[model samples]
Target chain A: MIVVEALSKQFGRFQAVDEISFEVQRGEVLGFLGPNGAGKSTTMKMLTCYLPPTSGNAEVNGFSINSQPLQVQEQIGYLPESAPSYNEMQVEEFLTFIGEVRGFSGTELRRKVGRVLELTSLQDARKQIIDTLSKGFRQRTCLAQSLIHDPPVLILDEPTDGLDPNQKHEVRELIRRMSEERTILISTHILEEVEAVCSRALIISEGRLVGLGTPDELLSQSIYRNAVTLSVSGKSAEALLEDLNGLEQVYSVERLEDMPSGALTVRVFPKDRESISSELEQFLKKKKMVIEQFFVERGRLDEVFRNLTLGN
Target chain B: MKGLFPIFKRELLAYFRSPVAYVFIIIFLAANAGCTFMLGNFYDSNQASLEVSFLFHPWLYLFLIPAVGMRLWAEERRSGTGELLLTLPVRTSVSVFGKFLAGWAFIAVALILTFPMIITVHYLGFPDNGPIITGYLGSFLMAGAYLAITSFTSALTKNQVISFILSVNICLILVLLGWGVLSEILNTIFPVWLTDVISQFSFTTHFDAIRRGVVDLRDIVYFLSIIIFMLMTNVVVLESKKAS
Candidate 1:
């Protein structure tokens, strides 16, 4: 449903979005993960035809953004980073006006507005002024406006930025439901959100695509292989570190200290753990090291994100 | 045209939903009425005509029209709604012209409210209603032209004050071009034909022709050309933003 080729945008001497390309298929939820000022919003703006790209081209629903912007705009609904709205307009009035501008009329416009308000859970706030609503409600209202036209493509920038935890969950659920029908490109910094909702993730840094893969694929690329943390007490920290480092299957080991009497926390990176766990058990028994706690430390999505982004 | 009507209706509703249209109408009517009755000496002049009342409109619209036009685009920029508006399916010219027409229509409402003055003139004596009608037609067209220019200026910046000041400055230049002082300066430096060409561009010349009850086709075309020209510039300014 969407294609971007070598899309670059420059403002004076600064390049906001470098040459980046990606495609989103129909009924796919693609998460755009990046830190602040990483060209996420700029990319969304170019795709929405709000700002023309300085180089290359972007097409939505088979229409070039630069050549046939009005047609492209007609097919895509965009919620900018700020989720801007007119404060003086009531919820229903604002949505109706947007629907009318997008070519909905009479019973169709009314029905669409009603459907979107219910979809965004903004039905009760329909009569309230936008300025009087809470941040969460305002965000929902912004979402309602974008959905009123029933566009096939949705470009949502930080759709859950200001919502509470429960509201965030509701929005995430709503997005998951909506993804079944529309092509969604959602930009956010929340790593867990991608794991929970997105089928694919695209990580961008410094206006460049750093990583793109599924959640498990990204987690497997971490430096630490599958290993367990063994808290031993009888052996000194120095001795445990020395013995773990000398093991043939051990890649690396680090001792974490809490206090003189506390259990030793050791993170072991194993090269070949199939035979190493039995060997380590026998060695610890012979050395008479008291093992208090042992648990396998799985790589987390947050750790993967931190490592990937920080390493670059 | 079907696409244009929705934008026009939305813009008109927006104006009324806030205090913008009301405040503009109230201040416009008050100032226009006060100037006609007190400053122009409507009853005291007793010339058996609305000439004095109609004469004051050019000066009134000079500043009042900017108030209506300054927010045409600047508020959208300030509120971060420009992206939302620009990304809609409607063509740029359609939206720009629709918005300009809405502002002009609101100003026309305020102008029409001055009918009491017309009634007062009709009650006192026999006034030439032909010139009065054409004068209003000329004033409405001039206001549309000025509002279009102001709307174009508003799109250039996010600051409404700057938009107002720039529009007033540009309108001042156009209003003053055909005056004796400007003509005297131009007559000394340029040939008589060049001076005449320059004077013809001034709104004052065409407006004067309509105020004399002539309704020349050339004057109508001149006013319309200015309106269309300024609206086209407004579209260009907005489109340039998308490019850079």
Candidate 2:
């Protein structure tokens, strides 16, 4: 549905988006993950034809952004970051104006406006002036304007920002429903949103694509190694650490704490699960340490993001 | 054209929904009426035509039209709605033309409200209606030319105050070019032909020609050319901004 190639945007000496290339398929929800000022919004603007790229090109639905911008614009609904809107206009009037500009008229325009209000759950605030609405309602009004045309692709930049938890959940559900028919590319820092709605994720750091895959696939790459923690009551932490360090499968063992009752919190780093669990069982038996709590810490998307972005 | 119609309707509605259009019309009419009747001695001068009323419009529009036109694109840029409007399916020229026509229509409404002066003149004596009609036409066209220039200036900046100041300064130069004070100064330094060419471009000169009951093609073409030229420049400015 969308193809961006070598898309780099520079404002004089500063590069906002640097040579980033990616493709989004139809009906796929792709999450663009990045920190603030990471060129996520810049990339979306190029796709929406709001800002021309300094170099390279982007295509939406087979139309070049430079050569056939109107055609591409006709097919994409863009909700820019923070969703700036005309505050003086009522919600319904704003949606109607957007519909008219997008080529809907009369009954079709009314129907489209009605459908978007329902989809964004903004029917109650339809008559209220946008500036009078709360922040959540105003953001939904921005979404309604974008959806009024019912375009095939949605470029939502931080759609759920500033919303209460309940409103965020409601918006996520709406995005999920919209995703059944439309191709969506959402840029967000919320990792849980990616896990809940996006089918694929693209992690960018310093204007470079660091990782791209499903959540589980990215987790399994061991960008975060499997590390287990054992709270044992029968042995001293120093003894446990010494014994665990002698095992072949154990990469390292450190005593996190030494309890007054002679218990210990030992953090064990292992190469893999199969090798470490069996080796630790045998090694702990020899050391006579009774394991109280033993659990392996799995890799979280947040950890992977921080590790990749902060490291780069 | 289809896209332009809706934009035109929306812009016109937006004008009325706010106090800007109403205040603009009221001030324009009150000033035009007061200057023509009280200041210019309309009835006491024993004039049987709209010459006094129409003659003061160039000075009125020099300031009034900018109030109507300064917010045309400047507000869009300030509110961040320019991106939403420009990225839509409609062409840039359509939006530009639609906004220009909306401002022109409001000016026309204000011109129509000056009908009381027309009625009062006709009530007193038999005035030549030919010059009156042509004068109204010339005034409306001249107002359109000023509006087009203001609209172009509005697109250059996001601050409405800056747009208003810039437009008033430019319009003031255009209005004063043919006057004796400015022309006399120029006549001493330049050739007579050059001075005439410069003075002929003044909106006051063309408006004065039409006010005399003479519908010269050259005067009409001058007003039309200024309107078209400014509007085309408006379109080109917006298009080039979008390109970069």
Candidate 3:
């Protein structure tokens, strides 16, 4: 649904988005992860035809951003970073205006407006002025505006930036539910959101593409991937650390702080990130170790995010 | 062009949606009445012609028209709604022309509200209706000319105050160029041909001719050319923002 080739934008002497290239397919939710000022919003602006690129090009629904921007705009439903809407307009009025601009009229425009209001759960606030609404409601209003046209591609910049946890969960659920047929490109700094809703994650830092893969693929790049963590009470901490470190499959064992119940906790590292769980379980049984808790880590996204975004 | 109607509708409704429209209309009517009755001495002159009332329009529009136009683009930029508006499947020229028409239509509404002045003139004596009708046409076109300049200045910055001040200064220069005192000063320092050429660009020169009921094509074209030139420049300014 979207293709970008060497898309670059430069403002004076500062390069906001460097020759970045990527593509998004239908039914895929791509998470745009970047540190602040990493050009995520800039890229989305180019894709939505809001900002023209300095060099290279991008296409949405096969319409080029440079030569066919109006057609490209027709294919996109963009939620700008600020989620801007007219403050003086009522919620229903705003959506109706957007619907009309999107080429719907009469009963169809009203139906489109009503559908988006219900989709965004903005039914009760329909008649209220936007300036009087809360931030989450305002965000939802903007979201509803984007959805009014029912475009196949959605480009949302920080869609959940100011929402509370429950609102965030609802928006994520909304994105997840909508991902069955549409191509979504959402820019956010929240790692958990990518894991929860996005089918693929693209991480950029310093205006450069650093990593692109699925959440699991990116997590596997972390140092903690597939590592086993065990809490034992029968053996001394020092003895267990030495014994765990001596196994052929184990590369190292770092002793962690004791649990609240006074059981010693340690993280066991595999030699090659392969599963040493079965072999270690047999070894523990032979050693007569009393295990309090034992589990293999699925890897922490924050660790992977920090490692990828924070310069090596 | 398909996008023009929706944008124009939204912008015009946006004016009435806030207190700006009512306050602007009230202040405009009150000020026009105050100028015509108190300052221009409409009753004492005993002239059935609306010359006294029409005399103050250029001066009134100097500040009033800019007040109506300054928010056309500056508010959009400040509130970040320009991104939303431009990203719609609309051409940039369509949005620009539509927005300018909406502001022009708003000033038309304000102009139409001054109908009682005509009723007053009709009740008192036999006034030359030709000049009066032409005077209103000239005023409406002049308001559009001034509004186009304000729209250009508004696109230059996101600050409404700056946009208001810039357009006021530009409109002041155009107004002063044809004023008697300024042209007299220019006559002493420059050649008559040069002075004529400079004042020809002034709003007062063309508007004054139309106010006298001439309805000359040259005068109408002058006001329309200003509107078209300024609106085209406004479109360029907005498009440049995307590149720079």
Candidate 4:
């Protein structure tokens, strides 16, 4: 439901966001992965119409950001980074203000505010002043403000930062809950979050679009993809290594450890999308070698992300 | 216009919710009464008109108006709420005008509280209330003009102190342009027409014109033009900053 085309933003000599283009379909939760100053926020700002792109443009729900900003804004709920809020206001007051400004009135305004407070789990702290709230509650309040209008599109920048593990899980669950029917785009430096909730993700670095695909697609690009680990007991390490080396579809087997309990651990790399698990299991059964641990490894995107973003 | 009520109500409530409105009003009343009684010699002059009470308005607004207006946009920028406010469905002009009106209304409340001075004068002597009424009108309009200027300066930076000082300096210049001593010297150093033109733009001259009991439409227009001009510039400044 969001189309960002060749969007670029520059602050004088510094280019904050280079030409980046991508689309997010309805019911998709797109994770924006980037390091600090990677232009992720800038790109989101352009889409939200908070910042005019230095060049190029974006469109939300078929309305061009440059020509129809208000229309575009009306459809998007933005939770900005740091979740800046009016510190002097109470939680309910701030949510009500947001609802009122969006043109909700009377029972409709009350219901909208009520829905958001429930969605964000902010009911207990509704009457508390914002400045007095703890950080997690404050963040939830900001999230409630964005969700108060129930807009179709949500652009949340670092929605789960600085929270403890439980609070982070709560916020992530909240985003997941909201992502069922809405097109949601979230920018986060937290790597695992992409895999946890996002159906697809876009990675940007140094103000440019560096990677874009599903979490699995990105993981498959990792150097560790499809590799398998073989650990066994009641076997001679050298003989097992030799037989594993001769197997088809197996490019290389690197022995990692020889345990005191007669256990052997070896990491086997496949050759070109091959699977040698069945043959290896059959050979072990023929020799009557006990299997301790055997499993194919999925690619680790953390490795891929570090390699891709840090390499540049 | 549609977004006006939310912004106006929020800002007005903000004023009362903080100590800023109460402290400012108390100080404003004190200064107005102090200037009238101590400096203007209310009893000594036996003056039926409220010339002394209104006299402090131009000077009072220099510090007080800026104090009220400095937080208008500067606080929003400092706390990063400017992005949230600007990105709302409301137009920029609506925010600017609504906020300006809130500050104007606060000052209007303070001015209205100066009724004791009027009551005192009425009890003391036979006074022409026409000139006193126009004087209040002049004070209210001049306060609005000062607030508009302060609001514009406040929009320029996130620093409230800088906003306060910059607006105070600008308002001071506008005030001095028509003060008797400054304009007298201007008439000598520059061409007489230049002094007249500069004095025409001063807060003092227009306010004094209204105090003379003649509510000339030109003087009213001049103050209004200043308010409108400053407000439009405030909108332009905010809009330009959004790009930068």
Q: Model 4, B104-127: lDDT tens per residue?
A: 999999999989888888898889
Q: Model 2: how far is B155 from its true place, Å?
A: 1.3
True contacts kept of 1: 0.73
Model 1 misplacement above 4 A: A224-243, A257-261, A272-312
Give the lowest summed-lDDT range of ten residues in model 4 chain A: A271-280
The CA lDDT at A149 in model 4 is 80
Kept native contacts, as fractions per model, are: 0.73, 0.61, 0.80, 0.54
lDDT of 3 by residue, B60-139 (tens): 99999999999999999999999999999998999999999999999999999999999999999989999999999999
Question: Which lDDT tens digits does candidate 1 get at residues B110-186?
Answer: 88987887888788888888998998999899999899999999999999999999999888888888776899899
Which candidate do you rate higher for TM-score, 2 or 4? 4
The C-alpha stretches of model 2 lying farther than 4 A from their native spots are A220-225, A229-235, A243-247, A253-267, A272-296
Candidate 3 C-alpha lDDT tens digits along A154-256: 9999999899999999999999999899999999988999999999999988778999999999888877888999988887778878888889999889888
Q: After superposition, which runs of candidate 4 have C-alpha atoms over 4 Å from their true positions?
A: A236-248, A251-262, A273-276, A283-288
> What are the per-model DockQ values?
0.70, 0.59, 0.83, 0.69
Provide the DockQ value for model 2: 0.59
TM-score per model (chain B): 0.93, 0.97, 0.98, 0.98
Point out the higher-scoring one by TM-score: 1 or 4: 4
Pairs of residues clashing in candidate 1: none
> Could you tell me how far off, in angstroms, the CA of residue A43 lies in candidate 3 after the best superposition?
0.3
What is candidate 2's lDDT per residue for B95-180, written digit by digit as tens?
89999999999888888988888888889999999999999999988989999999999998899999999999999989999887
lDDT of 2 by residue, A125-177 (tens): 89998888998998889888888888899999999988899999999998998
The TM-score obtained by chain A of candidate 3 when compared with the true chain A? 0.98
Deviation in Å, model 4, residue B43 alpha carbon: 2.0
